[model samples]
Target: MIIPDAESIAQARSIVLAALSEAHAKHAGRGFDPYEFGADVSPLVNAYAALTILEKEEPSELAEESSPED
Candidate 1:
């Protein structure tokens, strides 16, 4: 799992929204099914939710310090 910074989180949200929009368009044209969109996005949504919670709980210093550079 990647620990996303604020920028990465924003990018991920954008990507997810874009994917959902594309899925909707494809379904409208009968190229893909609506149900498949939910299946495809469920994991990304779940992971994002988990990451949001984790970010809130994480200590700021833990992110600021680098273990390898220690």
Candidate 2:
């Protein structure tokens, strides 16, 4: 499995938020596309949710990677 780090998860959240904002802007004073918004934001939401669950279960696993000593 390709596990994402906290930075990556944050970036994903930013991307989803941006996309949702854009969608809202485009649909302002009009009907929005639920399908499009759902498609754009679903992955980020799912990823974040999954990360949250994982964090609760194994918080320490998210610590910084350790380097080998010389």
Q: Please estimate how well model 2 matches the true structure, expressed as its whole-model Cα lDDT.
A: 0.62
Q: Compared with the true structure, what per-residue lDDT tens digits does model 2 show for residues 1-70? A: 3456667666766776676677667765476788876776677578657656644544345442333347
Q: Which residue window of length 10 is worst by lDDT in model 1?
A: 61-70
Clashing residue pairs in candidate 1, if any? none
Question: lDDT (0-100) at residue 16 of candidate 1?
Answer: 66
| C-alpha lDDT of residue 58 in model 2 | 41
Give the range where candidate 2 is weakest over 10 consecutive residues by summed lDDT. 59-68
lDDT of 2 at 68: 37
Best by lDDT: 1
Q: Estimate TM-scores for all models.
A: 0.52, 0.49
lDDT of each: 0.66, 0.62
